[model samples]
Target: MMTVNEVSKLTGVSIRALQYYDKIGLLHPAEYTEAGYRLYDDTALERLQQILLFRELEFSLKEIQSILQSPDFDRDRALDQQICLLTLKKEHIENLITFARGLKQVGGMNMDFSAFDTAKMDEYATKAKEKWQHTNAYQEYTQKNKGRSKDAEEALARGVMLIFSDFGKCKDGDPALPEAQALVKRLQAYISENYYQCTPEILQTLGAMYGAGGEFTENIDKAGGEGTAKFVERAISIYCK
Candidate 1:
């Protein structure tokens, strides 16, 4: 048996979090010394390892507790399921990267169905539940573009990204310049043509989101360079003003 401090050092689980786990009945000391110090056995350490694994996957503490305490909990089976889910997520990310590269190569002029179909893009979007897909812009886009052919959608996507690519090259330029504002205009028009009726208000919101980071920031920065996202935001400000 090991004391709480010893367990903390061995497992790297903070003493405070361990104490909270013990208080919440999620993990209790296996024994107690005469002086009332908590003592954990090897079995307890093993359980703590499992808890950490679940936490890494973003499961809530309460959910992790409940699942571990479930009558039918099967550790081996749970590990198998986690492996499968992680593998699927990996595949989804890899496919998106490949599709993005292909789009960049298309130059926004012609549709490329060499490796991916339009339906496939839609299918992946649904499965990934990307951040943009949750936005009003996406909703408006889908609604406006409804009933459009897959080929049309692919062409529109390439056109939109081409504008973004231009923005990527002007990270240090003034957003108020004709070139920057012109690209912003093209971006708005392209959206209106394909996805939704992008008013000035909608375009402004998109500008904020682009610089706000995550996939949008990453994509924009990839097209232009480091500050390209902020450049787009500034240009949108000028255009929408």
Candidate 2:
């Protein structure tokens, strides 16, 4: 585990920015020390890498948060897109550099402006953004959350955490038990009612995320207990089956 200061030094992200990210639910540390200092594990660092890559693509903090939190977010697919975008950006820069050097050599205005054309890169970025943001579930979430007050959104988020806290109460019980399964159903219903439809497939994905040892797992465990997130994941798996 690394302290927040360590992470800041390693990633060159300001400590204040990291704190803001935590406040806004962008990227949470893996755990906190008893002294209230933030600590991060490898999983958190990996997430930071993703965040940086998205930032390189000029995604807004809100957009990055949404994409990272999406149920359909695929890290590998995101990497692929990031790679393509970076490659295009690199080529564009190289072309511009060559064009500038040619202009300097001629010491006169060049009519050729093709080096500045970014239509292809811009088109790819637009398509990639659409792929990441225009999912039916995302559209539905946007529609449902339209005009929602900040307090209302916080209340809804608290409601979900409360369900996880309830899961903590039964962490020692069998996940296949009716009690655990019922909670899983309740969670699915709550998400579907307030956000997007929680199909079994999506729930399964969320379950995996809950236990995947990153911010989601950290938040769930914080709401519940140390093992509550893993227990909830198991319960959801059984419920989905």
Query: What 10-residue stretch in candidate 1 is worst by lDDT?
Result: 124-133
**CA lDDT of each candidate?**
0.70, 0.89
Question: lDDT per residue, candidate 1, 1-241, as tens digits?
Answer: 8989989898888899999998765777776889989998766887787687666455667656655533224467556555655665666577768878777897575355444434543454344333324456555654665575646655765676688889877657788888888899889887777666788987887888778764457657766778888889889988999
Query: Please, what is the TM-score per model?
Result: 0.42, 0.85
In candidate 1, stretches whose alpha carbon ends up further than 4 angstroms from where it belongs are 1-140, 148-151
Question: CA lDDT of 15 in candidate 1?
Answer: 91
**Positional deviation of residue 128's Cα in model 1 after best superposition, in angstroms:** 21
> In terms of TM-score, how similar is model 1 to the real structure?
0.42
- The true-structure Cα RMSD of candidate 1 reads 24.9
